[model samples]
Target: MVLPRSSSLKAFLVGAGLCGALLAQSAAQAAESSVWQDVQKAGVLRCGAAVAAPYVMRDAKTGDYSGYFVDLCRDFGEKVLKVKVSFVDTNWDNLVAGLQSNKWDLAMALNQTPERALAVAFTVPATDYQVSLLVNKDNPKLAEVKDDISALDKPDLTFAVMSGTAQDKAISSVIHSGKIMRLPGMDEARLAVMSKRADVLVDASDTNHLFALANPGWTREILPKPALAKQGVSFGVRRDISPADLEVLNIYLRQKRDTGDIQQLVDKASIEANAAK
Candidate 1:
């Protein structure tokens, strides 16, 4: 027993509408894939980052940039994407600004939280680290690891951090001592501890460890109290970037993580630098 002509017509219309919707979705995806192609045509992949030692720091004498962030991104460019990456030597305050203006194609070091996700799209988690406490070696006052950044609340304590960053915000609101000392950049923040200009520095755990090795007389501690927060490290791309390219990069990043290649790079870097003295 078959349906009447009117009923059959309605069913055909419904099936046709579903096919149209599927076709439209496929076309949209095709358009989105154009992003990576555009980058390839441009010839240079501009990456922006600050001079945060062990992250993306510069050499003092040669004025050349170096650090884990630099190493990681450069390899991602040459090895993964097979592109030529050029550095823009950006600052934290200007990272979002630069990306918005299209001055740079990507933000090299980014913390991918929901707030940041709104501003720009992020790649898969390249790494993760926690906020840690750094102090002079002789400063027994800070021996205990602080789970909360608020430990800086003691009127006698002060924090040194980059001039423009989330650390400054954390120090003002949570630490709340009104004693947050400002350094020009990450390099200076590391020095603030050694020169006795600042009591402590709060930054990413791995970076702080790099500083501890370099300074020798300084101690790096991830507070025992509680993680004030853990941030997923990732690369940032502007909202205007093509979704297709971003998807490809995302897949590329995930593959890199799954292969244990990421850890292998870290392990090799650790051995080569031997900075954790």
Candidate 2:
């Protein structure tokens, strides 16, 4: 019952062709499902947002989100990706870790700092801002040193910083003698100071402004402008993001910057921030 030589050869050729076809199909699918492709298939982008003042805020009662970064994220999703937007609540302390863990696709309101760059990739900066100090009005220790920014770096003073932020790094670098109370978010940092648990809280300009607005006469600005302390605020993504996707986001931010749309958004957020207080 042995097959003839020519028939055996013909069957072998058919099997080889089928195998080749299957391999080709698999390769095509793999190409189609690149990370960006998966994003497309999902039809939604997951953006990470933290309650950093004027940038992002959630209404406790209504569960509605507002602020500059929220609007930016929604605009990016709808205008660029043509996808539905979903926001995940995250805090600065865990923001980059969440991105690396695939919890979210983008981290909004991230400031580009040398330390953060080691862990995550940043998009084009949406804006430039400066950091300032927010201190409780009743703190007597700050009264004498209020005139000088560096004078507050005393061993007795305690600074409340949101964990894993540039503010934390700044205090750690400049004020080795002081104690730092690492909090979860800006609100906690402000509360720590107001309650006399900490001497001061360092935050970005608008955020400090928000604290002032919320707690009238309770807090005041000290060292309102730190020398050469400007920071670039940008969105962050995983370090291994596809180059094409990063470029797409960079181009979008550039367009927003050039057209003054981002500034307009900031202006609107400022107004809204004041009203919220």
Candidate 3:
């Protein structure tokens, strides 16, 4: 029905006010949403994770992202959260910086440590791994790893480590060895050792396990003692974010774990051993 000009003016003004208020609320929500929420809304979760074996990797045939950690991020962010997963090829050196600058909202996979806590808060340690020892398949002498990884420091023992990785941090404490080579990521570390350029490559236990399964021809041996270090996996979030924001994300993570969606992904990615079990 037609209204008086004065009434129409009032109605238009009221509608405009409501719209303004709604827009403001939306803006506030966008600001508050953890990277995960932003990902959900964007219809894609931009994740930063090492593009190496059994964590987050590209399939040689299909060129799709696939791995234990990769599957977790994709399934949760894509299937459960209903957001497509887009991964940023990353290594240890720049992943933290990427997050700080808002390059991506989260890391699909990472280990939690006290020092790292200063930069990012994890989502309650979803998985576990050991600092393992890898050696040449043909040579059996390097199979045994002593306690505390002391052998890594021997001048004759060439060891390769993923650059800027937690392994490098741990190794830094005692790397007086021949040549401590730095690789782009764990994958290259394995390659270095495989080609015999380096005597050893220390990576996560589960990562090693998965790597062996994926590449059946490569024979490897675990330290038999794991050498002792506490490393667990969790999702990464910005450090400066609100505690309330973290708690909210924790809620989603807990829900995902309880439903066994997490485990299912682990199995699918062929890294069930990496899961908490």
Local accuracy by lDDT, each model: 0.71, 0.82, 0.70
Off by over 4 Å in 1: 1-33, 140-150, 218-224, 268-277
* Consecutive 10-residue window with the lowest summed lDDT within model 2: 221-230
Per-residue lDDT of candidate 3, residues 1-277 (tens digit)? 9766998999999999999999999998777746545566678878887664556667557766777677666656766678777888776788878888888878756778888788887777666656776666666545554444665467778878898877777666567655688887776787888788888777766666766665557656555343545577787888866677677657767787789866776666565333311
Q: Who is ahead in lDDT, 1 or 2?
A: 2
Best by lDDT: 2
TM-score per model over all chains: 0.80, 0.81, 0.73
> Which numbered prediction scores highest in TM-score against the true structure?
2
Give the per-residue lDDT digits (tens) of candidate 2, residues 1-277: 9766998889999999999999999987666535455667899889888777688888879878888888988998888788888889877788999999999988998888887899999998998877788887777887776546678878899989888777777667777778889987777887788789899888887778766877787788765435425778999998877677889889988998999999899889877877876
Off by over 4 Å in 2: 1-35, 214-218, 224-229
Better of 2 and 3 by lDDT: 2
TM-score of 3: 0.73
lDDT of 1 by residue, 1-277 (tens): 8766998999999999999999999998776645556657887678897765455666557767666667777876777667898888778889978988888787876877676778898888777856777776577766663555555577777788887675665455577653788877876786776677778887877767666666564475555355645777788998867766777778877887899877776555544444422
Whole-model alpha-carbon lDDT for candidate 1: 0.71
RMSD of each: 4.4, 6.4, 9.1
Task: For model 3, give the RMSD to the true fold.
Answer: 9.1
